[model samples]
Target: MFDTLIDQFWSLTLSGIALGFIYVLVSLGYTMVYGVLRMINFANSEIFMFGTFATIIISRDFLGNVDGSKTLPLPKLLLTISLCLIGSMIVSGLVAVFVELVAYRRLRARGTNKLATLISAIGISIVLSEFMRMITHSRPTLNPRILEKKSLFEIAGANFRIDTVLTIVFAAVLFFVLDRFVKFSRLGRAIRAVSMNEDASKLMGIDLNRVISATFLIGGMMSGAAAFFYTLTYENTKFNVGFTLGLAAFTAAVIGGIGNIRGAFFGGLSLGLVEVYASAVLGTQWKSVTVFVILVLVLVVKPSGIFGEAVQQTRA
Candidate 1:
């Protein structure tokens, strides 16, 4: 049994790492938005769901299909995916904006208590999830009939799927872009300032509303991209896809240290690996239960999370 496990390590580990990339990218949005706003974006999963649906609608329904099989050309397919990526981000961002504007932002404008904010977030999350179910109830739509899963090359007798490679690359690029934006961009500086001290930021002539809105937008965009990547890889989707995926990604965020961007990234990767290995050792049915147990243990030992800031020094 031990030797059997070791033999499967190379393949399973690599696959776990690749899959972890998805969680990492999506978790970033959770971390970033929470980091700045001190408010949990409960509807983030909807952002991802909408992103996948957005891409599906664009490629298959919005633009209609191509020739006999009702698909787009390679160039067009690429374009569709690209557009889906951007469109999903945009739409998700808008959805977040609306959530903020209608729910949290208004309450915030009224200076509501933290508990009230949480209640509102939960309410909105339920509404969004149910709304999605109502719209796409029980439909398992296929992804755009694009690339076949194939190997660019093999390493050490391990084969990598095209989707795996693309997911990793996309997540890396997103991390890089986000790192650059936060470190060097002016908007990023404002965000940091706002996160550090909203009152002071406001006193210093920064538009707090605008900055917070921007934070939601960024987070929404990340979730959107995650949604698109998810559907593209899996080749199918349903209205309820957001629930489990959201929970897992949210767990990753908390495990890494909620509000710490880098922590979220690693947390996501670690969670994915742990879950995959747990399934290997236990079984698929036990994967989630094992993951939750690990999360509980980690929280008991370290409430702040692996990489999260102990104090969580935020404006809140």
Candidate 2:
């Protein structure tokens, strides 16, 4: 058992990091919305689900049909993947924006109670999930197995795949770019100003609605990328797929410091590592339990999050 554990170490580590990147991507949506609007967009998970479907639909169009036994030409494979990614991002982003405009905007305009907004979000979440279920008949959509799992390299007797490397590198690059944009871009400054003080930001001539919508769009885009990677890695998705994933991502956001992008990054990585190791030590069934246990511990010790700061205002 000890020898087996030692042999599996590097493989588990790589798997954890790849999975952690997906959590980071999804968690960004939760954290960004919370930072700006101080409201959890429960429906964001549906956006992710949509992205998965979008990728499947678009990739099928490009690749004709999924032939797992046949290998796609390198160029054709890359092109198909690219198209699927773009389609997923656009579809997810638009859905997120639509949700904001249709559901949350009116509530915000009316100065509705936070409870009302929360209830509205929950309703929207259910509606979206059920809608997808109706469309797909609750079937898990599969992706074309274009990139077979071939060993890219070996480290400490563990083999790493090209897919894992691509997932981590691609996600890391996007995260870095987004962090830079938020930290230095003009729109990012506007977003920060609005998050810090909505009334003051409005007084300063910042378009509050635009900033909020942009926040949702950006978050959705991240979730879309996550959706693509997830389908590519796991090869299937169901209408309710986002429920567990969204909860895990949300927990990751809280663990990292909910409202902080950097915190989400760290928190996701930590949670992924914990889940993988816990599952190995205990059982596959205990994986989710480990995540909640960490959540409880984090809440008890630092409710503000490891990287989160307390906000005086809860509503934007």
Question: Which one is best on lDDT?
Answer: 2
lDDT of 1 by residue, 186-269 (tens): 888888888777789899999888888888888888888888778778867777787777878888988988887777778888
- Give per-residue lDDT, candidate 1, residue 313: 43
Q: Counting only residues 3 or more apart in sequence or on different chains, how many pairs clash (N, Cα, C under 3 Å) in candidate 2?
A: 0
> lDDT by residue for model 2 over 45-80, one digit each (tens)?
898999988888887765685686677788987897
Model 2 scores worst on lDDT over the 10 consecutive residues at: 307-316
User: What lDDT score goes with residue 77 in model 2?
Assistant: 79
Which pairs of residues collide in model 1? none
Best by TM-score: 2
